[model samples]
Target: MGFPVIRNRRLRGSAAVRNLVRETQLTVHDLIYPLFAVPGTGIKHEIPSMPGVFHLSLDLLDAELDEIVKLGIQGVLLFGVPEHKDETGTSACHDHGIVQEATRHIKKRYPQLLVIADTCLCQFTSHGHCGVVKFNDALQQAEVANDESLELLAETAVSQARAGADIIAPSNMMDGFVHAIRTALDEAGYTHVPIMSYSVKYASAFYGPFRDAAHSAPQFGDRRTYQMDPANAREALREAEADVIEGADFLMVKPALAYMDIIRTLKEHFDLPVVAYNVSAEYSMVKAAAANGWINEKSIVLEMLTGMKRAGADIILTYFAKDVARWLRDTE
Candidate 1:
């Protein structure tokens, strides 16, 4: 099949031909929208760094949910901004916690919609670390207590499951987190609940907009101790392997745009569904360029997301979900 004899351009000659030969497809059903729920009566505050993304209150979720349902978006990943934070992140596992309340509310109204609760303590902890922090005598500074934090992470998973979250997504990046959360969920009589693990989260600068949106930036130190280093690719496989062994139902790579290779690698090596997180910074950059008229937002987003799917992401968690859904529908 030489190029001249093959005449590949024949397939690209028309929209009909292109459609027939298209190897990858992007659809509304592939999207998982991320929503932020804060504790308040009336609030729909737009995140400054991440334009168009709002911090919605429980009372205000109806509009968002209605739109999501209408858009044919299948799932929503939730993050909570509690009214209060503490050393232990007590609110993270409370029955009346912001995320729990939002989950219950969403399920009560839209029972069919998949609600995934983000099981992490960063937004709930006063120090903004994902886990419990303690003074390390050896390191001579306060450090995240991984083993101690596992209990809270497990408790958080159970709490979310109890609150009617369809899935528990643990983004803490702690060792054995999937095993801990899985054990806790099963023990709490939620054996059917699945764990979506952030298997290869990197401590990268690409998360600044997310930290701003979630208000989860560390107060004293960075998350390099727990989050994977950006320099290593093999480490991603080991991380995913551990989560797989620990019973993670889905493995996700955060900040997806720059990590498409990792996404492809995981899909090639793992049987479980691989998810790609089109993180805040990645979203904001496109929004910024689009706002400045430097790029066509729809074309760029469509191309980028299609590339992710082509890279073998089974599902994508993205802020652009709503727009992408609408775009796909309009095109159809």
Candidate 2:
């Protein structure tokens, strides 16, 4: 007979010993709820792809906020589905736009809750692109005009801040967008408004459900031209560096599950807080699999989120925010 000299299972023999030696911890404070707002009264339409999530109108927001706040979630990220669409996405910058109104309502009613507004034009543009597009005569193709798009993105950020957004999250991926929005916000006397830049958002297939929820899929070419390539890791660092230099208060890596390496890289390289978006498609996939009885839903959900935290995500923008918070509370 033989005996092992160092039995690793000794540490796992009890819950107390395991808790004391745990490397990463996930908590309610680490979550930021992503909310979709539409225009209307009494509208709480659930996105079919995302079973438990909803596109709530302003009239029904109170109940939603009440539930979120009661769950101990301190922050929310808002995406607006404007009623009107145009070539320039004019409604996106209007003070009365869906997101603006939602921000104001959320702030007024839940004064302590932090509201992060998604400052982008896709949901408001007729073409469903993140920026303004122009046709190139020589190439006979449409190209996103970077400088012009920056101008509109700045306007959108300022508009969101004026509408009472505590943080302005620019997810458009336009070059110099963070700098442009920072300058615009400061000039407009919103100097205190922080920029949560989507610094390393990839042109990922994991964004499909989000486009359905926000109604922001591009009409023609894909966002690959602007968003980072999933194949590159160094490029993510460069993107994060650019946003940091441009005055981003927080750096975000989108589609957290697939890009945890990027999230960890950004956190290790940058001094600012790192945020990871546990985006819609990621949530939907888990939900679908769990509904099919193929996996242990709750355990997997907690493990996925804890892995993100362990990978260096300081804040997580997740569709599972409320549910995770409730689960954590119940287990505690």
**lDDT: which candidate is best?**
1
For 279-325, candidate 1 gives per-residue lDDT tens digits of: 99999999999999999999999999999999999999999999999
How close is each model in CA RMSD to the real structure?
1.4, 1.5
lDDT of 2 by residue, 171-289 (tens): 99999999999999999999999999999999999999988998888988898999888999999989999989999999999879998889889888989999999988899999999
Report clashes for each candidate as comma-separated counts: 0, 0
Cα-based TM-score, every candidate: 0.98, 0.97
Error of 1 at 4 (Å): 4.1
Q: Which residue pairs collide, candidate 2?
A: none
- Model 1's number of clashes is 0
